[model samples]
Target: MGEEENISVVVATPLVRSQVVTLALLFLAGIVNFLDRSALSIANGPIRQQLHLSATSMGALLSAFSLAYGFAQLPIGPLLDRAGAQRMLGAGLALWSTATALTGAVLGIRSFLALRVLLGLGEAPFFPASLRIVREEFVPQQRGRAIATINISTTLGQGIAPPLLTLLLLRAGWRAMFAMIGGVGLLLAAAWLLLLRRESSVRTPPAPLAETFAGWAALFRVPAIWGLMLGFGGVNYTSWFFIAWLPAYLQTSRGISIKTSGWLAALPFLAGSLGMLLSGVLADRRVRGGAVVARVHRSQVIVGMVLSALSTLLAIRAASLAVAMACICGALLFIHFAGTSAWGYVQAASPRALVATVGSIQNFGSFMIASAAPLLTGWILDRTHAFAGSFLLCAVVALCGAASYILLVKDSLPLSEA
Candidate 1:
């Protein structure tokens, strides 16, 4: 389609609604999604103390969510392609919100673990659905900015969660905090369903069962698919390491008070949010100026990963708290640049019919590798009583991700092959 026709279609369609209501709702949903995800980490100290859990146990608790979220992608991807983003995401929003609210009622590790798993399953559809919308609704050149706009919520939610949840934790207690966020999510879910209720579902015609399986097998054979999976996994490992453990790291390692740690933890994520915006603008501008889609996005991811790795490595060796915080902020900023670029690349590279499938496969690999972050970090902390080792591991993973994108991901997935 021509650019003018694409613009007119977007303006006329409810799928985008001139890119106003849809993007706004998606942004809000993204923020709520991260807030719900971050609640456990924000309240980690109180929950661990009340439940009498060790670092190792807490790590396992965190991994429970990642494990479920990761595996769910295997099925959720195809389901989204078949069912549609609006229906799938709306249902996921309600389910996860209910699970988040129910978490407050858990009395022990087992119960909490179960709720976390439920939360993961509910959340598994989020990015795949969101990215599929970007692929289908936005024109190719606009997708970088669109993807980045949605992604900013991830960091923004993380940035705000510490302070917001901390205040709720102090005033109403962690249980009340969870209940409140869950309520907000339930409201958002209703709004999402209402917003998209009149729109036709975006779906491909159902293929026969054998054809569906064959399509999946073909996707598995694509070299770029594997590259995207492993590269994104490296990105998530570093990001989740911080998201899952940064606040606790501040309080335990720096001897900072819980109240102080909340604000301190927000800084890096704020930087991350800024980095995503910058990367997105740069990506779209370059692509509009006739840059190759894969080359532009791939170079951004590679550069961001390398810088993030260096920054993380430096953070672990900083001599003062200020220096450490600066380095951490830099690390987050660059990693988010990589994260946003990776998503943009996925949208630009995948066949339209397989965007969600490709994205979900990448996500599956990401969370599966990322689940190791908390578990391994906690294990290291328990034995050595330091976070330096964990940070080093993240730095290494970032470098490896850069290498994977460089060596393996070269071109878009061919529709015929897929």
Candidate 2:
């Protein structure tokens, strides 16, 4: 009887078992995304030595990735609406993976910058494709959990990249690490082509490309949505900047050994992974329970981001390594949770048919702004030789994200155009 009841509940829910596999693929793909992003960080030591780069140059490389990644967002949504997730994302994965491997062969900052730009171009479609998949594959109420599960990639990849890639760097050098990641991407892309192609059909069964673009009209008119975008953009700035430069900072300012820095970097990412899974469950329950779902559901993430911002400041201020580590962990927890909410907002605001387009633009804005943060921060560090000031810059960015959410977009779900 109990088994039957459980089956009934599962049956009634939009999270079909088949769809779970689809989400799992999405999650794994996301893991691949971050691992690719972290290739530079994991290999920073050797790359820096090989290229003899200044912090500003390193920062420019990261900025180039963001600049390309940001603009790439524009076309992705429209294409996802037209071509479907399997083909668009599969092609994107191939492009970015190849770009990552190419990074290993680059001779200088200009080549490195060019490769990163290409990498961004290939990576541009990921979130939009995922958004389309979830909307077509899962129910609205179930999206946060599915999105959360997909988010595990961020937690898992970021967590593993620091330590795992570090080991590869130690064993084979940084250039080799890029090759390793690229190889993994090739394998995953093949797997996606074979196993996940079946799931892509649902994302855009009969949806017209024109209809998807038309939906953006509503998005542009929505003030609250802008608030959400601005807030999340702030969070992304801090999180992405830290991701881009933290390794160099640890190596130069914290006086940590290379292997040790990898382990230390793993701490925040690990905390963030746990936070992603936890916040997803919590947000779902609160939303279903009859509370003001909009304000409260988003609050789970907003509050997390706010806390993350505060911890970043604390991390920058700490005099001791232990204190700094503690604060970094604190900030990381919020970053992951904030993602849970930010992505959740995308799930909510986007109509079932137009989700990919909405998600693409939103994330595009975040990354567009993000392109500058790393470059600016790296330049500041190079010029000033002060880690605290760079981190202070980090704190301010996160605070901007928190304020945008609080003051402007305070809803959990988008208004349906009935």
Candidate 3:
């Protein structure tokens, strides 16, 4: 072969293997994204000490990220509508990954807060885009499995973050830990850029910003969507609380060592993953059986929320570590149950053409308030030195989340062509 022929053969190798399938790359990207978000929870102890942050300051830092995350949804949906998920997601991945690496360099709470805000902005498009992918690629009956499978990556990533970071923190320290997360992100993002195709994000006539805003406004008119969002927000509070403060709680409240804390903290998420899978599978069954779309969604979310609330309450009172882990897992399973329903609402509620817009708004509303849960829980912990109040509050909010979906949105909305 000619010299050029040899080079062409090597170049073709990437086409053959460097780029994998679309769904596989997207899944890995989601995994890396969650890993970055959950890393803070894993490194909470060291970061708190290194910066001398108070509960409120720490809470503020956590809240800052949510603020960006929540608010970004307001506009990102429309942007995705115009630009498409593939490009938007690729850009977001690069932005957030770099921010994760930069987090290791902050010397004070201010810079850390800034970094988190930026991180939130970068990460905001991830779930929306993922949901878009599921909606576009999977058939109606298949979406639950696809969403659940993608959600699995979230739990798996979060489950892995603590144990993995715990190992890194012990050897290289927390700065190195953040840097390592950045490296993982780079690899994932490269995979995404190389492998993922544009089939899902193909563009056409744009949804006018005025009408997009108007479509979002329709959410306000419908008490059901509002209630669903409120309930979803409540669920977020509990989940994020676990992500942000569980380690600190274990270290201070339970007197568990960091190593054991990593293991313990991971347990619930593992359970949550199972719950996620079960809920999706069950939901698919319901849809296949000809259950009303809204009712199936309601049933799934309600089951999860009720389970989560009870499990959380049990977790608070449990005397033994094994009991607590068990309780937490039960709650996690319930939590995942609501998760599929919540996304299902987004899929069902939105105008088909503007599915991304509706989904984004659903998430934006929920996360806007949900984003505060971590910081709010942190503040409560710092003041009272216990998670009981925060967890209880979260429980109440979760109940509200269930009620919103069950009572408010049970009557379906009339769909308009986008």
Candidate 4:
């Protein structure tokens, strides 16, 4: 072949083959990650019956995982930057998977709570590591789709977990369900190691202690980071509310059967998956249209958050179950539409070197706020014996998130310079 032909072939080879392989592995890993975490939520009713726990106590149990996950984010960024995503993620998958399996052995609330904490610690590296990998593998222009693609695994896991696990729970029991999900995670971990053997990030030498501290300090100096953090925090409140409580809500509040509730609860997350994919496409087109990266991202987030808030309010006031599900689905769709842009904003704002750090910081703040959702919702339900107030709280938080994107995070300059 001629020189130009030869060059084209070489350019095309690594981009397609390696990128696809890496993303596939990461995507599958993400699905398994969420499946394991969501198992408890799926089986919440059964577990509560067996353990004789109240909503307040169950909320605490759920918070155990989130608290640990949120706290782990504080240190996970530096660990990813120093150790690279490959080892960190592989080890995390193995550890969390093992924790998930062992959850089947828990004899009481205390042991289950401890296992949940372990699960959080093990899974903490996932998103930060994934973000770092995406930054390394994809070009800036393509990053939105790449981010969205991996994120869809989240919705898939959430969407599938309810019905699938409910079936497992009905047939085999919750313990068996945990063991099965955990085994899937372990298999995925091994696959992740094998599939990416040729794919590893070059580990940079650790910075001096003072410099490392300063880098983290610099992150806090950026107002956009804080804005993104707060904005996304509100988004998480909406998401975690559904993730943690939807099945129970349908079963108790809507008077739906557990089996049907499982299927119905999956609808919102399925819609979210679609929204994520569409948002990524729209974000890329906006960038191609000469919009600044920050503006493109913030615009999507602001619009989605506002619509999500409105939809959430409508869901609360929805006249019937069908109407309510439709409204809730719309809310989730818009939340995820903004969710895609939220990560895109993080990537666009941070320099390549600090993608993991920025992502972890965002995760930390988001989870910290999200951690409260289940507990607060439980508390609200206990007090009011209703979901109207709980759904309203989600709407208000989402509106705040929209305001943060519009007013606090300026789109003019990248976060590195801010």
Candidate 5:
């Protein structure tokens, strides 16, 4: 019953306009977030040469962002629960935008790492806050689609970033690219602050400090929360591999030029975006048709992870660049299908009072391991000098994620009520 207050919504006619606007804004924010991150990977080749850095050192820079993103979640979660998503996310947007702009001014490795950390900290609250907004604004049936729609922005941003950032890099250089993106972020941040203030959506009121802390304590007693964290962490290890290293892998291992790789790199992400959108529709339909929520969500994840693994393994054996790209696309499509289901479940399983807290934990867990993906991929690539080993490693990690979800997460259970 307590859970229903959060998960169930009667989509009134009057609410439609607000919901649409909210989703659109969130989608834009998602794009900006991913674009900022992906720009670094797209320009990594030039950055490495200019900085005279090894693959390992470049990997460290990438990991630094993720590490800060994950660590910030612990504190940010409580802050969001207290302060509200709109304000917190607005502040975060401004901070990260400044950090992104400042990236253009980095003088050395230390300054580079510091700014990346700041960027991570600023971006850390965006996803959890977005989930909270979706939970507050949409009915359960609509939530999956909303989550998927927003997540598609991630893929869209990734898909666009390679060619977009590469073109900018070629024209104005990497520093100018960062500055331009930062400017775009500032405009988006302003929009977020302005438009969101006008919408009247459902929100959980802040509880007393003691009561809120007590709720946080109770959350730790729920085994499913821990299980969710572990399962998602495994998935993140593989997903981050694509996010941080795919472009570089395409260029270095496949012998593609940077320009060609930029276009080719867009394929997998575009496929992933489409897959996420489909999963949203399917998951909502499944639930609306009276399928058990736990079974539907968990099964989606398990099946998706298995397919992702198989596709990735097949990618290494592909005979041509086109075939390899197709394989990677298939892999990402399945992975996003699984990822969307998992996020949908977060809303379905959480209590209304603690949705953001639960989501922050999920993000923290994923990024903790995800932070390692770049470093590990770089180390492996530096040693093996081929993409095959990295692809194989991703496949294995996806399998482990599947196993974790199957073993630890119970089918069709609302965890907050536990």
Candidate 6:
């Protein structure tokens, strides 16, 4: 059978109960993953005050996590392909949770920075592993919706973090907040390992090291991979900017209280969750109707990125808080629409055996670009005392990402090649 025919044959099988359970666990794990990442941002003000750090220092502290996370992706991708998601994800959850918990005890910038780096290392395997699971469990036509379902945890965690972490920061303080969140993650890790014990034992045998290296070299030669890398970088540049700075921006720039900022900051992420859901449904429907998978997903990504750029520019220009919030919501909605479609694009564009490797490489490039967002925004705020420049930069990057997808990433990758 041809590649498309093989995919159809896989899709024709009924969805099994184990797949549902696996997806549920993956979703839960994703929520905790983001919650840990966002904790520092939600408590940015308190941490800086307590540690006596400047905005630039705080920005460096934030960037430490992404820098480590991005670099770790290079190795973690190959590890996931060899070791399987069940083992890798469980181990990652445990390591990151320990790092998160240890942050509560740090005395200064250096120690906190170290813990953040560790946290990033621990979290690096998450998306690559999760995407691999989706690829293994679902066929091509169903992967978009499956991936979207997994991606929803990102926005949900972001949406919930502000209010939840704010309450924790207020009631128990930031240290206690980190400790508690880390404790919850540890529990989840144990649960994951136990639950997936059977599934973990059934992985494919490890590929020869030389053959694996050859596969990586071949993937690097594909032109579309470069487009994916740059395009994803644009998406992460905007997404991580909001993830790392939105709460603090509301308080400092808009003169809103932390409590109110916490609530307000959630609006955009909530909208983002909806956007991802919509994109998934739309992509699947079009593909099921005999639309070309790459064309459908790429068009969704391009349109979303363009709209996201426009909305971001408008958001920064809004005169009133309500107007700004509405515009920000619109921006996130479109940005996340692109984000989901981008992952779908990754799924459609990768060889089956190298799905996690491609995802990790894409994530590595994106985060390498994104790691700059927090630092740059912090530097701009310290110098100019405004977010206008930062927002404008994000809008420009989004447009560039749209152009990358439009001009490159033309079709599905060759299935015959690894």
Q: Which candidate would rank higher by TM-score, 4 or 5? A: 5
The lDDT, on a scale of 0 to 1, for candidate 4 is 0.83
Model 6 scores worst on lDDT over the 10 consecutive residues at: 1-10
Q: Which stretches of candidate 2 lie over 4 Å from their true place?
A: 1-15, 199-218, 412-418
Across 328-401, the per-residue lDDT of candidate 4 in tens digits comes to: 99999999999888888776766556668778888888888889888988888889999889899999999998
Q: What lDDT is obtained when candidate 2 is compared to the true structure?
A: 0.76
RMSD of 2: 4.6
Query: What is the Å distance of residue 232 in model 6 from its true position?
Result: 0.3
Against the hidden reference, what TM-scores do the models get?
A: 0.94, 0.91, 0.90, 0.93, 0.94, 0.94
C-alpha RMSD in Å of predicted model 4 compared with the true structure: 4.9
Q: Clashes in each model (backbone N, CA, C under 3 Å)?
A: 0, 2, 1, 0, 1, 0
lDDT of each: 0.86, 0.76, 0.74, 0.83, 0.82, 0.85
Clashes of 3: 1
Candidate 3 per-residue lDDT, tens place, 307-326, comes to 79888888888897788778
Better of 1 and 2 by TM-score: 1
Q: For model 6, what is the alpha-carbon lDDT of residue 261?
A: 88
Of the candidates numbered 1 and 6, which has the greater lDDT value? 1
Model 3: colliding residue pairs: 231-401
Over 301-413, each residue of candidate 1 has an lDDT whose tens digit, in order, gives 99999999999999988988899999999999999999999988877776666778878999998898899999999999999999999999999999988999988887555
Sort all candidates by lDDT, best to worst: 1, 6, 4, 5, 2, 3
RMSD of each: 3.4, 4.6, 8.7, 4.9, 2.6, 2.4
